[model samples]
Target: MAQLERFAETRTPASRVDDVVARMRALGDDWPPRDGVAVFNRVYLSVTEEVARRIHLGAFPDAHAAITLDVRFAERYLRAVDAAADGHRPPACWRPLFQYRRHPGVRPLQFALAGINAHIGHDLALALVDSCRTLGCEPADLEDEFDRVGDVLVSLEERIREELMPGPDLLQIGDPLTHLAGAWSLERARDGAWASARTLWALRDLPGVAQEFGERLDGAVGLVGRILLTPLPD
Candidate 1:
């Protein structure tokens, strides 16, 4: 416990993200490559690495603020990883994906999409608030950086679909994956995250209101995650 806490304390945002990328890479190398979670981990690892490299090159106007936002964003996922490791419950939005992580019937695309749903749907809004608090600014101030990060995620979604999508022989016009993918939109999630972040910032002074809003968001996202993780017939 002491060691973990100490390790957490010592890591700056960049180092923490680097560690996450490394851990994800190791998971990809060590775990079954076709395992759904492993597949998403690999996809997410690519996004993280890209984000970290951009951060190094001063891609953003405000590096500190960007780092704060990125770190807070990454920390939510890391916390889920830690909680699951320790046998503790993670956020509801994340529970479905974790529960279905190794379900053989769940496709790799489902896993990737489910994880994205959990992270963007629940964590992104809260992370904006975290960055706001840490940087002592409003959510609006972080919009540019948020959009940049979101663009990276959006591209990852494309890569994931192209790479993990079932072959034409296995896919049909009415396939469950097709229907599911058609319904879930990263653009919508990104827009919603922005709205939620603004709302959270507005409710920041009222902890009770903020908590309620966040809980509702969590529950809604969890429902979506559940649907995304639905095991399809092989």
Candidate 2:
């Protein structure tokens, strides 16, 4: 808990992408290797670093929009971590990872996937809305940035599986982990997030409906995240 407090302190204002990357790195350093949140943080940190590098190299078509969207997207995850550390309930989409962060039966792959599920399925859409509001633009204007970020995540998903998957000899076809992993697709989640963002943006004028819609998305994503974190034998 004390360690979490220290890590939470590392979160600076998310005005700069480097600050967000640095804070996530601090979290990766503070958390033990097996801790579920730590595992997710490691994966997220890598994505952030790559995104930042691309932004630096002018790889994104609109670097400003890309940087804004990336930072906003990351802030949502960091806020959830801070909320958990402070003993508060995070967004519904994040509850499962926080609840199962240290369960012995949960594999590193499960942790990584659960985190990705929460972030991509739930946070990404809202982050799009956030970026739009901040940049005084619409979701359509940010679609390119969104796609670029999604591409980075999709590419990373393969590597994450390769690195976190159990040895092939032990991971037989009958393994529950194999079945569980096959059940969720990052690409599908990314598409859903984009749709959700568009819907949410359209509902911006209808605060009541928008709030309800966001809540439903959060709960639905949380359900998927919980399923992804299902424990299996070592």
Candidate 3:
């Protein structure tokens, strides 16, 4: 947390996106490839890099909104990482991943998906509100940016499944892991995130209600993450 805070303190607003990429890259280098968090980090790092590329090419209708949303979105996940590292409990949505990070029976795909579930289901809505506050715009104003980022995540989820899915011989429909993976949908998660963002935005005037809603959102997302991470047989 201190390290990231210091880095943020020195960074200019224009460099914030780059700062996020650098932090994710550093985390990747530090954690073993098979570590559960590392698995998610690799997946997220790839998505972030792709989004950065698209932003550079003017792919978004509103690049500034996209960048603000992207950076704010990434910060939520990074803060969870920092919290766990500092011996503090991460958000409910993140607890499952951190708890099962090194479990031997959890496949890389499950680790990856669980992390994605947490990030998209819980972190994204809050991040949207954060971005809106920072940009002085409503969630509706950032809808295009939100959808663009969600598109990147949806595409990446497909790739992650392909890369981490077991071979066909072992991935029978009867397999528990197959069933588990089938139950969660990145596209659905993305849609839910947008809805959640709107809901949070509406509740913004009631800070206590918003906070409670956010907490419940975190717990519900965490429950799904825990299920996604259910251990499978070797």
Tell me the deviation in Å of residue 31 in model 2. Answer: 1.0
Off by over 4 Å in 3: 1-14
Candidate 3 C-alpha lDDT tens digits along 1-234: 456557664676548888888899999999999999999999999999999999989899788789888888998999999989999999999999999999999999999999999999999999999989988989999988998999998877777888999877767779988899889999999899999999999998999998999999999999999999998999
For model 1, the superposed segments whose C-alpha errors exceed 4 Å read: 1-13, 27-30
TM-score of each: 0.91, 0.93, 0.96
Clashing pairs in 3: none
User: Best candidate, TM-score-wise?
Assistant: 3
Worst-scoring 10-residue span by lDDT in model 3: 1-10
What C-alpha lDDT, on a 0 to 100 scale, does residue 138 get in candidate 2? 96
Q: Give the TM-score of candidate 1.
A: 0.91
**lDDT for each candidate structure:** 0.82, 0.90, 0.91
- Residue 135, model 3, lDDT: 85
Each candidate structure's count of clashing pairs: 0, 0, 0
Better of 1 and 3 by TM-score: 3
Residue-level lDDT of model 2, residues 23-118, one tens digit each, is 898888899999999999999999998988887888898987897788779889988998899999999999999999999999999999999999
